[model samples]
Target: MAGEVVGHAAEAAAHGVDLIPVVALLGAAVIGVPLFKRIGLGSVLGYLAAGLLLGPSGIGLINDPESVLTTAELGVVMFLFIIGLEMEPSRLWALRKQIFGLGVLQVAVCGLLLTGMGVLLGFAPAVAFIFGMGFVLTSTAIVMQILGERGELSSESGQRIVSILLLEDLAIVPLLAVVAFLAPSSGDEVGLTARLIGIALPIGAVSLLIFLGQRIMNPFFAVLASSKLREVMTAAALLVVLGAALLFQAVGLSMAMGAFLAGVLLSTSTFRHQLEADVEPFRGILLGLFFLAVGMSLNLTTVAGSWQIIALSVVTYMAVKAAAIYAIARALKASHAEALERAVLMGQGGEFAFVLYTTAASAGIIDGPTNAVFTATVIVSMVLTPFLLIGMRRLMPKPEQSMDGIETVAELHERILVIGFGRFGQIATQTLLGQGHRLSIIDNDTDMIRAAAQFGFKVYYGDGTRLDILRAAGAANVDLVLICVNDKAAATTIAHLFRDEFPLVKVMARAFDRVHAIELIKAGVDYQLREMFESALMFGAQAIRELGATEDEVEQTIEGVRDRDAQRFKLQLMDDLSAVDAARSLLLKNAAEQAREGGVDIEEEAVEEEVAKSTQPVPPA
Candidate 1:
């Protein structure tokens, strides 16, 4: 009776709860990401580990990976969307040769070489052709993240890597068509007209998005903002992405490509920054889940059974691709170190390789066993990328690329260290740069960093709260560090962190409000300016002078206000708010009394006449 009851109860629970995949994925991410990060590996490896552990090869936790893949695919779509937002249309145009010219050369040269090898290994010409196209792709997500992390995304090698990746992304739909043509399929399903329609969908979508994006997004965001709820804003941002995705899928175009077009369209809008902030958290979580799903698809049993063949394939894949990329880089006149470093970064087979394999398998163009082998090779190549990058850094000699390389953060030597390249940080940076002071800007927002780079500011990618990031940005060596992020907690954390680590480097912080200012002051920040404090003070000065005070009196009043605020900040604001408040009250009273005694007074009627005259603009000399 007891055994029967337990079995029944288990069944009921299983039927009641249907979130095994979500729970399992979250569990893996929670367990894996931090551990990998702790051990010096990246979040990508963490996601991979989560997938491997939950996959059939490990515990068989995710028995139905296909369903997970359906969701995980959204990750790539979001990734592309963000990438589109990072580069403007005009900026993308500037790299036309890199995107079209060199891109075609690299793919044709690499694909043909790999195809030759595949044919030699006994694959049919058609099979060899598929392998050539698939293996020609490099891991865009991994390589681009690594490049951005190392602050090399705007460098020479970085530019080359991006151009190729951009071309590969654009090629996916067309390549799928080629694969369809090669496959022995019914004309009804994969006919010439159907292919043309598919091709037309993406082109038409791009044009439509370019035309309609700003008009819809700006007003849409304005309405969302008027609601004054962040959640509403986030939902609308997601609506733009998913709505675009659905539109593209309806027309038989790539969902990812459609979302990317949507993002690019929104990039030109005033709501770009707000939209990025809203979608960013979801994008990150989903992208990692995507990598996790890919990891889970790797069947360890298959890998072990054909270990020898798989190993050889992996080696050949990396070697052949690296050779091709290195040759191309050298032909482009890249220095030896830059060429070799880029080659290692580009050698890994792409995420799209596995995607194409699955697509082919579903279309019956490739058998299950063969697809399994291809999948293993692509995954292993991706897994080896981080280690390969690390090895390259260790082995390759540094290059004489720039005056300071700007390739790595450690080499970033500037007098002014500005943290957070958002709107606030940009104001500080633009001012400092305009004054001819050398500056090193750091921000985790790659989009902001990329945009700033277009205008000649090289911003490093790293979180300001991290000590290592600060050290890498040369905080200790710099004379002043500016904390200009909008997040109050983050601003406070950075201020305290710098005080502990680089106390000698004076910090000037931008506070969100009075409460935030108090927190920053407690963090040992030498100077804290509330974001609107000066503007408010200036407006108050104008109001005071118009209320009958002379210009000299107005100036003195503003000076006293600043002095009083500084005195309040100097107090122990956190532990003794009562004392600080008392001091503030006393200061205000004494200053008011002093002002009443010292300032010149005017009759009320005379003040109104004088104010009307002062409101007029000064005549030009």
Candidate 2:
């Protein structure tokens, strides 16, 4: 009976272990994600917090986190992949001087400086070097995320930091390769030259494979994509990621780097957007899991033992890094406020630090106690980042004069209306303004509104889509409604709301594209301009020059296509069904016939087959 009881107990324990991860993940998403979002903090922090709470140190839901960590590692790889995809090769090359020159200098200077300090603190030279390498890489994930949230991603300072971070990411490969070669498991007598060669050989092989694969992969994907099988396309995407990762591992390089390169190659493909949409859901879920695993890996026991050292290290590292970044920004000619903001945002150690430190420790280059201290310090620094950004914002110098110039009550007309403010919107707004229209423009972006206000234009901050704000903006008496918001969703919502609430008012909207115009038309939008119409006309004029067509002939052809598109547009608007299908069929048929007439022997049937497989009914619009 005792034996029987022991077996049953063992089985129960096994089952409990299996259920822990599921419970931890579910609980974290349920409790943490919403809480973080509600507080206007990013979900990343919530994931990290959830991981820490349910990890071995907290609720002990995850005792052995290795599997989860591996999965999470894939998330990082995918993250980099997507980032690389967004950046074209030309753009990357344009920034090459900064990425390589400034980036290399920053890493070398920071690493050496930090290493020297580590050695002075009594660490061996090897250990100090390892630590320096780990410290040199700032968190690309955190910095990019923060920049994106604040809309500074396109700003000068943000771009510089992004370039630096990209270089650091690249630098990690070499650093890890060196650590791997120097690992105690390897023979002590192995020469540096041979070790370097060992690393180089694998990298070369991987590069060759990627080059060759691209030639084949693109066409293969093109064929599959032409088939229009969602399942097949999704499978192909997964294959690209998993295959590239596995290939990298086989070549002895990091999988993340391989995934990044693969994404770079795919960025050149015409179907990049479609692939992005298909892969986004998978990427998001996997990334969340990856972050959760990172949380689970936090060793509370180690942190507890070296809290003082960890605290001091974090403070010192952040201070030094921030100062270094600030100096770099000034040298790079950034404004003082911009430099300060950049410094604060990039002061923390990042996800790459965790990877580097762990790899170094595993290679026996760093002692266990030192690794624990540094790891904990990195985590602490990350925790402080959000607060640091908040403080930076508060410290920004306030302008002496308010930009709002609503000096007189008469200036605030009861029937306040806004016209276009974008390149598209500006023309319409200017035309109306020249006619002495009493309009108060509404724009969501604070910076844009400020700029316009500086030029003595009256503008207000509000999302035009929101009915409450519109009502507050005097929708009752507003004689005209201008729905010039760039975002399609916002434009649509505003039009619908305006029509329902104030049917008597005229509503003019800017369409995002041809499809957008059709949608607006269906929704009873008064006047709609295709966003690309003007640009297309300009292009047509340029094409006429190259094609040797007379001005009249060129204009006639342009008018023909426009009329056809407009008639199709109207038909689509009226029927409110299968516009995209009719458009694609018409366009593809024309192109196929042209190719065949040119003796190119184009596959019209194949093209149609692919289109039939690939094209989906555009949602509503």
Candidate 3:
């Protein structure tokens, strides 16, 4: 009895020990993330700080960071999966040029430069190459997280950066193979069969993954979805992600790469959005943990013991890598601002460095002390990246775009001022021009202005949302202001500004949709027209005429639509009955009815859909 009680107590103690690390990690993340974000250091830094505080170097809440890191790496895998879901195969194909062209160039140039720097720092040639190549693979999690936070992930420049990162991810495979080849030959050198297997295995794993993604995944998801269990769906998502990651890892390929390919395959799946939603929570938590693990993995003892070497290495490596990246970007026609941003983001060695260093150490290519110093240097560099970006933002000058032939908004006496020169503005300008109304045109797009100049349109470069630009464009002197910009928010702001500052000028604005129309009305614009309303009405009228309706019938039908829209608009403005709300309620009713029916007739669903669409407010054009 005594022995059993003692055994039970020991078991309980073990369980408690397991629970404590989880609690500490969560507590640190909860505290660190918010504090860092509030202070403007960013969540990544917050996680790092929290991790460091809990690591062996600090209070020692968690002694083994490597164990945490192994699990936390799943966060990176899921992140890549989510990114893959966003990148449709077609869209990814569209970026093939940038991916292969710019990606290859950046990697080759940065690798060579970093390798040369390593050599200059007195490392042996083979060791220097490993150091350089390891650093060459930038932290995808860090870059992607920052871009996502800034909402630039879908931008053209962002896509270009993503392409470079993709190439870097692919480069890891060959880099690992290089590490193996560079390792000092033991008495028993690797056999030819082993070398061939090493090469063939990764390729086979990738091919198997492709086949599973194309042929099995969607159907597998479909089967799981039919079960109609939310937990089961979530489990399936995890299974797919983990399974793919495991397959690649087993074959010595990148787990993140495997997950990414799986995501790309599922990008066109009907379950794409559902998969994203299911994985998002896990992705966010794990990714944070991953960063925390990275922070904990930082060997402060190692850093402290070899402070000079680590510090010098961090500074020298980061500088050389950043310079190389910046030069490559500039060579690829990136603007100064873009090149600088890329440089700041990609300056540090990533989590992959640890993997490379470990492999090299295991292979006896690098000594333990060298591995420790290099690892410490990488961690220091990662920690400094956020600070470097902050400094760059503060100190970097705003790039001055060439305006050799472009004209700025000047004081003009024209009767009308058109703020935007987009398709809508250009078409509107034609009507006023036909009526012989003198007007001044302004647009924020430099390329558009240049394009317009080719066709003899005197469009000036000016931001419509800026008060100074509006004033310079003679908004106060103009009889009317045309806010024909595509952005709903910008149009509303311009309208509100004119109503307050240029009360004498009648503000006529283009609405993005029904909601925008209401917003413009609240802004007290003298005239507001939904950009697509008139055109859509005309299109429908033409369809009616083609369906054998007489000319008068088509005209009368269009007039009825116009009148009903006006009535709805007025009602929406007065907060009486919202057309949008009414339409939403109708949709909910239809959905509920369909659910109750357990599969409504196809014809009925179509009819209900048409009804919903007709009354449904069109989204922003």
Q: Estimate each model's TM-score.
A: 0.64, 0.65, 0.70
- The segments of candidate 1 whose C-alpha lies over 4 angstroms from its true place after superposition are 1-15, 185-199, 398-621
| TM-score preference between candidates 1 and 2, better one | 2
Give me the candidate number with maximum TM-score.
3
Candidate 2 per-residue C-alpha lDDT over 393-429 given as tens digits, one digit per residue, 9 for 90 to 100? 7787763344354331122345646634666666677
Please report, in order, the local distance difference test score of every candidate based on alpha carbons: 0.78, 0.75, 0.87
lDDT of 1 at 169: 72
Query: Candidate 2's C-alpha lDDT?
Result: 0.75
Sliding window of 10 residues with minimal summed lDDT for model 3 = 612-621
Model 1 agreement with the true structure over 1-621: per-residue lDDT tens digits: 967865676677687975655787898899889998888887788888889889887788677766786787777777777777776777778889998998999888998998888887778887777776788887777776677668888777787788888888777777777776676756655568876877787678766776668666788788778999988888888888888887877765667778887887777777888878877788778878878877887788899998987798789878998998899889989877878887888898887787678778877788999898888888888888888877777776754324232334665788888888887887767777788888887877666666777887777877888888888888879999999987888899999898798888888999998778777766778788888989899999989978999999999999999999877754535345455545655665555556557884535565445445544432210
Pairs in steric clash, model 1:
none
Taking all chains together, the TM-score of candidate 2 against the true structure is 0.65
Q: What lDDT does candidate 1 reach at residue 11? A: 79
Every candidate's CA RMSD: 16.4, 19.1, 15.9
Return the lDDT, model 3, position 522.
66
